[model samples]
Target: MRVLYTSIFYLLLPFILLRLLWRSIAAPAYAKRWAERFGFFSALTTHKKVVWLHTVSVGEFLAALPLIRRLQADESVQLVITTTTPTGSERVRATLGDSVVHVYAPYDLPDALARFFKRVKPSLYLVMETELWPNTLAACAKRNIPAVLVNGRLSEKSARGYTRFGALTKPMLQHLSCAAIQNSVDAARFVALGLSGDKVIVTGNIKFDLSLSDDLRAQAATLKSQLSNDGKHLVLIAASTHQGEDEIILDAFAQVRASSFAWARGAVLVLVPRHPERFERVGQLCASRGYSVVRRSEHSWNGASDILLCNTMGELMLMFGASDIAFVGGSLVPNGGHNFIEPAAWGLPLISGEHLFNFAEVARLLTDAGALIKVNSAQTLAEAFVRLLENDSLRVEVGNAALRVALENRGALDKTLLVIADYLRKS
Candidate 1:
């Protein structure tokens, strides 16, 4: 199965290169690092006693940060973090500083994986989330590098696809030395998909351990004071929004502005898109919605502007600190939703769409605790925003509840670190 997978991957190599070329024409940044997939193999050969961690993109890197930090700190480990996206590599560099080596993961071709393993000679390979590449797993197993799936999750959508190719996927998963899952449901999914039950351990979600440095918090406070100098009564933060979600948030903001409540008169909406490619599009969307938009990428925020478009990267946590109420994106349009815990950690009352399978447990806990509002449509979302803005008492109640939920779920980092430590010792 592994050989067949590798052969198919190589057969499509030319088309993949053409796709990269097309993307480069569409977005120059995507094209600039076209050879990054091959660059990993080059870097791997130079590093000794390498411990490679594979993540698909920025979110997974952030989710696996605590584990990365622990591995980097270990004297026996030479940490190598590989991400499939440019944004993920950038984030790993920013977050890990000088602690780990960052590289773009090689494509799952046998030769590429072989070269990467030969160069890095990784003692242990850790994969984040559900990025299970058959060739990569087979190559790691062949090299005798114990591959572990850390903070792993198996979404229903992903499970269906894997089950369709169970002959290939089951053997790949069974090769893993351990599967540190996010929750019991994830463990069951992995077990049903062919992983031994003993190999899958529920470690909870490590995203709850998201750290906000004092410097970052201070910067956010400074930006908040500068942006809301005249004492704006409310700041509605639309965070990690996807395509259509921004439109709904903008409409909700306009409704809040037109409300009869005195506090609604000076409300501001901070719109943040989920990806960098959509920054300009989101800014245009905000402007089209009749908002006087201020772009963060321009390092300019006008206090008089009704909306602030955060066109920057890796600063959502800071924005969360500056927000009064946050609408977590991805949920609004069935994108499975982004992390809501960052805002919750800052005691910001949260709102989201009904679709939150990505962070279902967090959403459930927040909803049960009255820390978050789950709305089904734009009208319901608008009403929730207005209610939170008008009723300061309700905002306070929900905000405190959110803080409590965040605090209660703070130990996942410790548990993940212990698992990585055990792996290192055994290796």
Candidate 2:
């Protein structure tokens, strides 16, 4: 089954490259790192042992940073980080700087994985989240390197997809030294998928262990003042929105503004579409709806604008901090919702659509704590916004509940680090 999987992957390589080329039409960075994707790189001579960690994209890369920093503190560890996307590579460079070596993950062809393994010669290999590659894991196993999957999660939808490839997935999972999953549900799924019970541990979600810099908060304060003209406007942020979501959000925003809520006249919605490719489209959508829109890249916000388009990356957290209410996106359209941790950390009254399988546990915890509200349609979303804005005490109550939820969920990073440290010592 593994051999057949690799053969099919090899045959699809050309199509994959063509798809990358197609994506490059919007994001030119996608076409720029062809060599790194092939595992062709200048050799580095280092006496210290190498530790390789791989992530698929920006979200996983950001989630792994806390763990990466913890490992980097060890004198014997030379960290090498690999990401599958150009955006992830750029983020690693921007955040981690020269502290660790960063590279694009090789295409999972056996030859490419072999070249990467030979060049890096990693002492330990770790993969973040759901990025298990058969050839890469097999290469690590062949080299006798301890490979661990940290911060693991298996959504029901993804589990069903993997179940279809049980023959290949079972053996691929068995190659891992450890599978530190997010919760018992994920652990059960992995065990049912044929990973031995002892190899899987429930380590909790490290995303809960988020760190917000004082500088970022200060920036948010400045932005809030500029956007609201010294707290005169009510700020609502709809973040990480998908295609179908933007239309609903805009409609909801219009409904809220026209409603009898007292703050309706002062309301301003910050629309942040998830993908960069849709930033312009979302801005146009807002304009077509007759709302005065301002882009975040302009670094200028006038209280006059009805909508703020957060077209820039790495500023989502700051924008969340500046808002009075947060509506997490990706749920309205069937794309599983994004991380709610950011808005929760800000202690903002949060709202999302019904679908939230991706961050099920976190969403449940928040909803139970009265920090999150789920809406099914544009009317409900508008109602949620108006209700939260109309009552100051209710907003404060929900916000405080959210803050408590975030506070109570602390220490996952410590647990995760301990597990990885123990594995390193035994290895």
Task: Judging by lDDT against the true structure, name the best candidate.
Answer: 2
Report the poorest 10 consecutive residues by lDDT, candidate 1. Answer: 39-48
lDDT (tens digit, per residue) of candidate 2 on 144-187: 99999999998999899999999999999999989989999989
Q: For residue 196, what is the lDDT in candidate 2?
A: 95
Report the Cα lDDT for candidate 1.
0.81
Task: For candidate 1, write residues 289-380 as lDDT tens digits.
Answer: 77788888777776778888887778888888887889999998988988888898899999999878878778888999999998877778
Candidate 2 has what TM-score?
A: 0.98
| Whole-model lDDT values for every prediction | 0.81, 0.89
What's the CA RMSD for each of the models? 1.8, 1.2
What is candidate 1's TM-score against the reference? 0.95
